[model samples]
Target chain A: MPPADHSYLTKKVISIGIVSELTGLSERQIRYYEERKLIFPDRTGKGTRKYSFTDVETLVHIANQMEEGVQTTELRRELKRQKSQEEVKRNMLRGQINAQFHKRH
Target chain B: MPPADHSYLTKKVISIGIVSELTGLSERQIRYYEERKLIFPDRTGKGTRKYSFTDVETLVHIANQMEEGVQTTELRRELKRQKSQEEVKRNMLRGQINAQFHKRH
Candidate 1:
């Protein structure tokens, strides 16, 4: 599928039902998970949940981790750690680009 | 502290109390965590809980994750994924070392 924006490619946003199918979990279960605040899916104007490729990836990670008997506390920490790493990467890349732009100017 | 058998380094084992101190979790909580199969720490002959640096790190992850509302099931799945990644790394390294050994022979 084409991306929502012109920048990133291949990965695209999907409906909650599609997410449930990809994650091998029931729609009710997915909604339940969101209510518990495990994941925050985007909402439509009609209040329907919208899933993204990123959300599906996260669900895959959660499913794999649970199979190994990891507890919620540890999982949350790891997710946060991953997010921080992503942020750090973005910041480093941005810094490099900014440096290049200034150098060019 | 010194290494257990000296394969890898920097990390060392310690008592459950030490684990508690390092992870900021109570002894009862730590024991509870183990009983739930969240972490598998070593056991002394007297059945005392012996935690390693790795176990403490896992506890820290659990604590942080729980505070963020991650469910137990999801946490378990994530842990399994991480374990698989580690195992893959080990296998790849082993394969490389074996290749080098065969080349020498």
Candidate 2:
């Protein structure tokens, strides 16, 4: 089994202002994405939103893709679909690997 | 630079039934994609939709990606985005390559 990596989970969160600065996405756009459930940033005790470096990176990629003539609606679906597809593929592969190990025993 | 390949455009056209058989996507679904302007097939004299080999391949790819957990909306956007992105990238590259060739003269 591959070693678990949760380093991203521990990354610091940035205020909405900082996130917008880093991603070049407007605060309104960020909030809209959150409302659409495109991203789920961390929350502070005072109920402020915080974004990680990965989130910023994802936003950048998303923005770049949008600029490449991809419709925003379609892009959202593609991102969601790719994520789910990989999860299914991974599970199936892991199951096959486990089955092979079991047969070897 | 890659040579232009328009061979797929000349491939045979299949009726809705054949497309469903080849792609495992329902005739309704195939027709629906066309309605959504996702895939544009040819038209018979009787106004029936005629799908080429490339159209069939595209439908299959779209279906497979949908099965992979991508939202249809996002997938469509992604596909469109990727296509346009590549076109832009190609043009940029071609321009640069042409600039270099001109400098040689």
Each prediction's whole-model lDDT (CA):
0.67, 0.73
For each candidate in turn, the interface RMSD (Å) is: 19.9, 23.4
Each model's DockQ score: 0.01, 0.01
Q: Which residue window of length 10 is worst by lDDT in model 1 chain A?
A: A5-14
Clashing pairs in 2: A70-B81, A74-B74, A74-B77, A77-B74, A77-B75, A78-B74, A78-B75, A81-B69, A81-B70
* lDDT tens per residue, model 1, B1-105: 433653211122345654665578889888877766688865555676555445666889998987899866677889789989988998999999999999999
Of the true contacts between chains A and B, what fraction does model 2 have?
0.00
Regions more than 4 Å wrong, model 2: A1-5, A8-12, B1-105
Query: lDDT tens digits, residues B1-105, model 2?
Result: 654644534333445665676689998888877776678787766787766667877898889877898766776787789899999998999999999999999
Tens-digit per-residue lDDT, A1-105, candidate 2: 753634433343346765676578999988887776667787766787766556777778877876898766777798799999989999999999999999999
The alpha-carbon lDDT assigned to residue A21 of candidate 2 equals: 62
Q: Positional deviation of B50 in candidate 1, in angstroms?
A: 1.3
Scored by TM-score, the top model is: 2
